[model samples]
Target: MATLVSILLLLAMWWLTMTTGALAISPGRVVATLTGGGTRIENLVIIDRRLSRLLAGSLIGFCLGTSGALTQTITRNPIATPDILGVSAGAGTFAVLALVRPETTERLLGVSTTVALVPVAILGGLITTGVILTLGWRGGFDGYRLVLVGLGINALALALTSWLLTRAEVEEASVAVRWLVGSLGGVRMGDVVYLAPMVVLAVLVCLRLAGGLGALRLGRDIGQALGVSAGRTEAGALITAVALVSVATAAAGPIAFVAFVAPQVAMRLFGTAGPPPLASGLVGALLLVGADFLAARLPLELPVGIVTSVLGAPVLLYLMTRHLRRTSV
Candidate 1:
């Protein structure tokens, strides 16, 4: 029932995106446009422009939310998101680097700019995850150690990103900055085509692994005794998360706390011991779609990331306060 409500809310929000934007198309017009009965202007506005933004926001949020659930569940930490774990930072770094220095990236990586920066971004995220997992697995990928190591690595990745930006041309830097902050603006159908299948498949993978993950929460030994391979499940979840973050970053930049906040909010709403992937994904899609709507309507115009950060910061602080109290007790 909660899941159904969440999905309905996502659809409601997405519907509002079409009907309530700057152009102020009516809901009826939007429906008509979809069914092929609207004006030329309505078709261009709804199909060419707004629909891409809607799909981009929805897809990015869903993937990030699912990734966050997997990461938090695997690490057993509510606050452990791809954003904090250096995956987003790493993916963003490489993607931004490619944007600002496409020639160099192509030269060094033997990748073509014609194909987009997805490969470089995925490579960067995988490399970063490989290092963090290797280090975090020194004895075990415990939540505390993973978060701490992730913080250090995340800082380094951001520093490198900053350096790359400073050396970029003004035009390139302007483009890079917008992408870095996460904008669903200028999304095209081609990008959506690339993103849709992967996001759907990845979320399905996360859902398929849910039973084992739920059991693994009891403890490794218990999970292992129950015929779950702790190592295999953890690896699969983390890898899925990395792929989701990498591809989404390549498509839409690192969109801030959708990954972190979505899962936590879903856990609260559903009363789960750990965040559940599909429900968390629905909430995430709602959050991002809603954030994009707000960003679009705001007086100054803003990247969607700013809205997410503003909304998610308070939650972060509240979680920190709770974490502190629990640890101190």
Candidate 2:
């Protein structure tokens, strides 16, 4: 009931802000813009321009949140997330690589923007995620080992990203910066259409693996004892997690903490001793809606990524400190 109420509240807030012009587009006006005009200018701009970006952000948030929970559960690491695992970084790397190669980037745009990002992003995500899995394989990818290796990968990826940024032209760098920050501006319907199927598929995969993931928390030997194939479960969960994060990064850049914030909040709300995938999805949707709403209202026009980082970092720090204290005691 609380989850349902929270979803409804966020929807209401989104609608209210959009309708009141607080979102930079009045509600009635935007709707009319949606339903209005054949061959009209404002109508084209609203439908083609605004609505696509809105949906893209929302959908990506849902996928990322669900994936985050699955990743954390599968790896048995509370801090494990798409961003932390270098999935987004790997995806972003491929994306920037494509953009830097004009001939290839042009060829990519031929199909669709979202499609262009998906293939490379998914490949990159899987590869990077696979590396971490391999690194943590013998020890069964426990929380501490997973996090430490992942942070190392993340650091290396960041350095590579900086190197890539330096190699690119000035105009490309400007574009890359915007992509890195994550935003809903200039998104196209093609992007929405292309990304939607991948997101849905990834979410369903996450749902299917939820039981296995729950069992995984009991530790590998116990999970295997219970008839769970630890190897297969981890692989599937990792694939799903990578796909979700890849699609989101490809579609809307890396929205840093949606994965982290959503699962944590969901677990708290559900009173679950561990991560809840479904609950995390709902929380993710709510967080994105609220962040996007505020992004629309605020003077600096922050991206959803910025909002999550600003708000989530402090909360994450607190959790870490509290956990450390408890463990030490």
Candidate 3:
């Protein structure tokens, strides 16, 4: 019931946002446009422009939130998000490279730039995750070691991304900067079309694996004792997390801390001890759409990522402080 209400509120906000951009349309007009009754201009603006951006933002948020829940579940750590774990950084690095140096990626991958975006980003995220898992492995996953290695890798990826930006043409750099900051201003229907199927597939996989994931959360030995393949469950969760984060990053350029913040917020709202994957996804969509709306209304028209970062920083700090207190106790 709560989730349903939240979704309705978010949809309402999304509709209002679509109706009130540069060339404002009223709610009735926006509804008319959707129902094929508005002027051509209204139809174009509402359908082609605003709706695409809204869908992209919503899908990205849903993916990130669900991905974050999976990561935190598998790692048994509240802070184990794609951004903090370097998955987003890896995916973002490859995505930026694809944007700025399409020829290089094409030459190396023997695929056109358009065909390589999501796959290349996914590969980067998987490779980074593989490295983190390998380095952090001490017969099994260690949350602390995973975090340390991931942070290190994330730093390296960011540095490489910065260096690449420095080498790009001025115009390309400008475009890449907007993407890196997770802007939704220029998203089109094609992006939504490309991302929607992938998000759906990933969500289905997450649902299929949810039971195993829950069992694994009871600890490796206990899960194994209960006939769950701890290794398989962990691997599945990691791959799902990577796929979700990679696709979202490719679509929206990391989008800051949505993955990290959404699950926690959802857990709080639902008063659940474990991350609620579906609810988290909804919360994520809401957070992102709300952020995008605020960004559009802001005087400077900042990227949605900036808004999320500003909001998430305090939550991250509070989580860290709470984690510390728990450990000390």
User: In model 1, which runs have C-alpha deviations exceeding 4 angstroms?
Assistant: 106-114
lDDT assessment of candidate 3: 0.86
Q: Which stretches of candidate 2 lie over 4 Å from their true place?
A: 22-46, 104-114
Query: lDDT by residue for model 1 over 1-329, one digit each (tens)?
Result: 88888888888887887887678998888999999999999988899888888887788888899899999988888878999888899988988889998788778878776355888888899999988888887655688788888898999999999999999999889888888888888677878887898787886787789888998888777888999878889888988889888988888788888999999999989998888987887788899999988999899889888999999989889998999999999
lDDT of 3 by residue, 155-238 (tens): 999999999899999887887888898877767777787778877887788788878877877887888898988888888878
Q: Candidate 1: give the clashing pairs.
A: none
Give one digit per residue, the lDDT tens place, for model 2 in 107-220: 746764435667777777888888887886666767678788888888887787788889999987887778888776646787778668876786677678777778888888
Rank ordering of all candidates by lDDT, starting from the highest:
1, 3, 2
Write down the TM-score for model 2.
0.90
Worst 10 residues of 1 by lDDT: 108-117
Could you estimate the TM-score for every candidate? 0.95, 0.90, 0.95
